[model samples]
Target: MHEDIHVGGGLVTAFVAYALAAFVILIILRFAFARLRFSRYVANAPLAEAGLYVCVLALLIAFI
Candidate 1:
């Protein structure tokens, strides 16, 4: 539960880890969404994508 993690002789916020994990998940989601035509389900596709990132980040922080 540290606020920072050391990597390659430097300290970075723990949030960065969560953010990166979320980004990877988002990348996978992107492919799935492409196949599903996700844009058609949302009026603002970009906003929905951003919201998905936030949700994924929160879940990672809460569970991992």
Candidate 2:
């Protein structure tokens, strides 16, 4: 079994850790996307970003 994340408050569950990691990655991805002018190419920028977030979240959960 996987270990829980130790935090100042307490231990966070594995799924929560995966979600937090994914969110951090999404933040970095947002900056890169903005620098690349990604929104200009997408028909629905927010929706695309949301999809990216879900993909990142899923990958994190599956791999780690």
Candidate 3:
């Protein structure tokens, strides 16, 4: 009988940690920009919001 080896846990953990950090940073930036009146400009620009969403998603996917 043989035991199978589990691999890639460290890489997965790092990806999860990175994703959490990125989420936190995004939340912080969202609030900060709102407080600074930047969100108003952002709201008026649908393209910007779409672009941001795409970029964040790509980053998350890449980390995974």
Candidate 4:
């Protein structure tokens, strides 16, 4: 029996790609939230931001 595994640009490259993607997503979310005054309604803005970042990162990893 034989098995094949494919590695994408090795681990370090994958990490950097995901990190850059998350950063870009967070920045865009920050601007959109600020422009729409979405943070005013949240009792904990920092926590909300963190949650949003995680969610966005998860979505990106899952879809892309």
Of candidates 4 and 3, the better by lDDT: 4
Question: Which scores better on lDDT, 2 or 3?
Answer: 2
The residue-by-residue lDDT of candidate 2 on 2-63, one tens digit each, is 68878897997888877788999999999999999999999999999999999999988778
- Compared with the true structure, what per-residue lDDT tens digits does model 4 show for residues 1-64? 1132346754344545665789898999899999999878999999999898888877777776
lDDT of 1 by residue, 9-52 (tens): 99999989889989999999999999999999999999999999
Q: Measured by TM-score, how close is model 1 to the native structure?
A: 0.90
lDDT of 2 at 39: 99
Work out the TM-score per prediction. Answer: 0.90, 0.81, 0.45, 0.72
RMSD of each: 1.2, 1.9, 8.1, 5.7
Clashing pairs in 2: none
TM-score of 3: 0.45
The CA lDDT of each predicted structure is 0.94, 0.90, 0.59, 0.76
lDDT-superior candidate, 2 or 4: 2
Candidate 3 stretches with Cα past 4 Å from truth are 1-11, 43-64
